[model samples]
Target: MKIIVFLGPSLPRSEAASIIDAEFRSPVAQGDVYEATLIRPDAIAIIDGYFGFQPAVWHKEILWAMTQGIHVFGAASMGAWRAVELGPFGMVGHGWIYEAYRDGRLEGEDEVAITHGPAAVGYKPISEALVNMRRTFASAADAGVMTVDTARQLVQIAKRQFFPKRDYEAVITAAQLPAAQAADLSHWIRRHAIDQKRRDASSLLHWFSQNINYLSAPKRVAYQFSATVFWAQAVELKRREMLSRYPGRKLDHARIEQFTRQTMGNADVQCRQQRLEQCKP
Candidate 1:
């Protein structure tokens, strides 16, 4: 069975591959899944994705993949968020993080967002995920590493920081815990911190591996995909990008512009042209 997994900082590629043998790609961005559908893999598992710095994978593309009979599974970071939003539409969600979002216990992307290094460094995390910090604080409180009040204070501090700057050291410093207690909590965290994202990501990979046989069969969905003008534009952009990769493949720009105008209507076309002109220096 052919399966593709979009993965990144939530878990290392080597660790995930050890759990499930599949074609693993870097964190998914806009149009990535749509491009994957061209390959018609039996199933696709989304564990991590790009946002903020890049366009995120679109829900329309995922629905389109399902309409094409490809099974879609989501969990961990971006996957968990998309799964909760698209579950009723046929996307299968797995792991505790997915459940947390589905049940409304978690409501924001900040819970999963973490700053990380480039893919060349295996997307090394430079900041802690709020979800992991929450879990770790709770665990520390249960283990008597800190008081329940202290744990709650830490959570609040972590939540207030922007995701890119959220980390244990910052939270602990902001909380102003006693020096000895701070040292003890830090030591405990280094030893027993719960990496909820990685755990959920691994669960997703394992679940996909176990169900590969069943997933090999075509997926059936109850909804029909509607290709709106935006989706068409995305498709056209992808086509042009693919064509640009080959030499001597001349593009008919005028024809493409005509098609765009027809799909987007003259008013929208004019608005886009005005915006383009405004950007000129």
Candidate 2:
């Protein structure tokens, strides 16, 4: 069996512990959720429920998994966006394909699109959903005419609530509501979905700027905190895997931290470029 580590969306310490403990040899050994620091597991997976709203953060992990040859997948919000943006990495989700192209990572000159909205959760590749989402967004954008900002917000709102077969209509309903009403509704959805774009970037940036916050500060802090948690988990996994390899060998902690930092540094740089590109006209 492939060893997968689910990351993102700060789960309750107890809930995260349940998944990690039930699945890994030591769930709370070093208090981390990622399995990479200590073990070169055969495969790793991520749950979008954790990081679906934060696109920048989600992309880093997706790219990291892809580059490392790990099979990565996402479910909603962050997952839906990545399933399309990093489809080259292979994924599964619905909606956000247009935004993926808007960011410039998902490019298929061939218009060969696919839709399996009615399939089982793990059965369909997210790439198919991306194609379908593109069409849906295009229609939603053009239907009954709306401001570009409204359309943009609609796409953003759709990211978190987008489900393969079940919640698609709800996504559309939310997307089609007047921009003002939709804004209020987004707060409710974001509890389980991330649609930061619903609030104009200018307003958000303004609020941050007024408070002397750097553009990257919130995202960076989130990255550091989550990465630290993941690193800790990975270290424990590595130690145990090493023990399995060498019956009584003790594992090294410093080496794991160094390795995790190096890998994360590379992901940070790449993700920075992605965020910059997404802001381009």
Extract clashing residue pairs from model 1: none
TM-score of each: 0.87, 0.30
lDDT assessment of candidate 1: 0.86
lDDT of 2: 0.39
- State the lDDT of candidate 2 residue by residue for 100-155, as single tens digits: 54467455422222222221232133332333344444554455334456655655
lDDT of 1 by residue, 170-245 (tens): 9999988889999999999999999999999998888776766778679899986654546556766666676776
Give candidate 2 regions above 4 Å deviation: 5-37, 51-58, 88-252, 257-281
Model 2: ten consecutive residues of lowest lDDT: 213-222
lDDT of each: 0.86, 0.39
